[model samples]
Target: MSQPDNPLYKTETASYRERWIGFIHGLQDRICAALEDLDGQALFRTDEWEREHGGGGKTRVLSGGRVFEKGGVNSSVVWGKVTDTMRTQLKIDGKNWFACGLSLVIHPVNPYVPTTHGNWRYFELYDDSGNVSDRWMGGGADLTPYYLFREDARHFHRSFKDAMDAFDTGWYPKYKQWCDEYFANKHRGNEMRGIGGVFYDHLRPADSADADRLFSFQQANGNAFLPAYLPIVEKRAVMPYGERELEWQEIRRGRYVEFNLIHDRGTLFGLKTNGRTESILMSLPPRARWEYDYQPEEGSPEAVLLDACQHPKDWVK
Candidate 1:
């Protein structure tokens, strides 16, 4: 990755660049504030760091709270020369690149409250002459619950569906299915990480006009995060739990870890490209457990979640 050659950047590209950077940064602040209020007991500690090769990022983490056990909301802006491996992964050839994105993950104290992950990003590739060679925008949100709740799942999906429907009526189904396909543990007989929300990437604009429209669509979905997730967190966070429930949460978190470490592209991209280890792995839960092929008792809540993960449901229809 390489720094943005400002002198060669087109005027329009610079505007969108500033727009996305401001948007993600603003979202980080807003989400952190809302989560702090929801917890009512803890504040996120901030760590501002600079990437040794290029740009820097701000990582804010909250831990050991009344509601949220651990969580992170991070925003980063980085640019540098592209490498051969990156070219192979991205399937593009360029000497330089610029990327900006916001990534977040939240794990709650109550097993009933589902864990969630969401990210939005923009990428641009530049040729040796510093001219923009390609650009795309991508993002989505999804849910993972230890104890399946039909209504909570419905609420979360509905919030995002409504957001996308406002932009394109057909996008909900397409993106929803895409989400199910993208976040899966295929090695484990195609089990999913969560109930599914919307996931999309490489959303290149069809025309210059669509660029702003896509940006607005990104805003709509990004803004939808709080309503989609916080309401469920509010309802479930206060629910009572015990050692058994906590144990189950950790066991399920084990799956979350496997997916992120072995299957997640973001984690891979970050690690391969020299991204900060702490910020990237912040998506992992504070606690996790793995047993020797541990199986939940028949009809147990844990089994129910696994069932949903194996056979994803249509939450909205």
Candidate 2:
């Protein structure tokens, strides 16, 4: 597919913060629509009030479909007094917060392809005097393919890396490594979630001069999502496969479930912060299988992919 001539870029406006919110909402709509069109499944969204936190969010979920195994696209705009733990983690004093963001995950039914995730957020902290104190940006996109596809992996990585390199060459390799390390299953001796994708958090403007640069970087990464992922999905979604491959996919999905439930910081943060329960847990796959001490036979294609997951590749040279 040819790249769109009119790329989405961040613009400096008097209402920059509002524009960010609008951008996230627009992206959420676009991604959900694309997935629905490709997969022939409609997302079921729940508009529920968070009784625990006195806020509300819309959680869109799709499962048991022809194309998607399961997927969720959700957005929450919550406000309350920051907890002690949050203050310490954010390194800010006691205050109230106005936080808003969009989070999503897509799990395709096919084993040959990859599951993907992307999230972007804007936050605001207000001091006792109700003056804005600490504000920052965070979030990223990642890929998790059950079966290895080297060219697809390279394409995905190169798309994102080129986007980052346009802003700063230092970003792609650094964030790519960070993505690999961040999604690792430490208990399993650092087995990665998938081939690496860009991840970053808690980014702030270094100084007056750096603000525009940082915004540019974030925008570029955000706009790269379609190019980085959709092509891979389209290429692999139709590859013929047998029941053995499907079973193996479920087995691998079990590992994905383990990582998200046990080790994902996003999961923990959402759960701990009184975020929406269903939306937070929607990252889990629809079906997964766990076997006691399961190991693929040596020299099998499945085993080869597992070995590669254990040791990630340099997808972009």
Clashes of 2: 0
- In candidate 1, what are the lDDT values of residues 246-284, reduced to their tens digit? 998898898889899988988988887789999999999
lDDT of 2 by residue, 20-43 (tens): 667766777777788788777656
Best by TM-score: 1
Model 2's TM-score against the true structure: 0.88
| Model 1: worst 10 consecutive residues (lDDT sum) | 1-10
Model 1: lDDT to the true structure: 0.89
> How much lDDT does each candidate structure score?
0.89, 0.76
lDDT computed for candidate 2 = 0.76
RMSD of each: 1.7, 7.0
Task: Choose the strongest candidate by lDDT.
Answer: 1
**TM-score of each prediction:** 0.96, 0.88
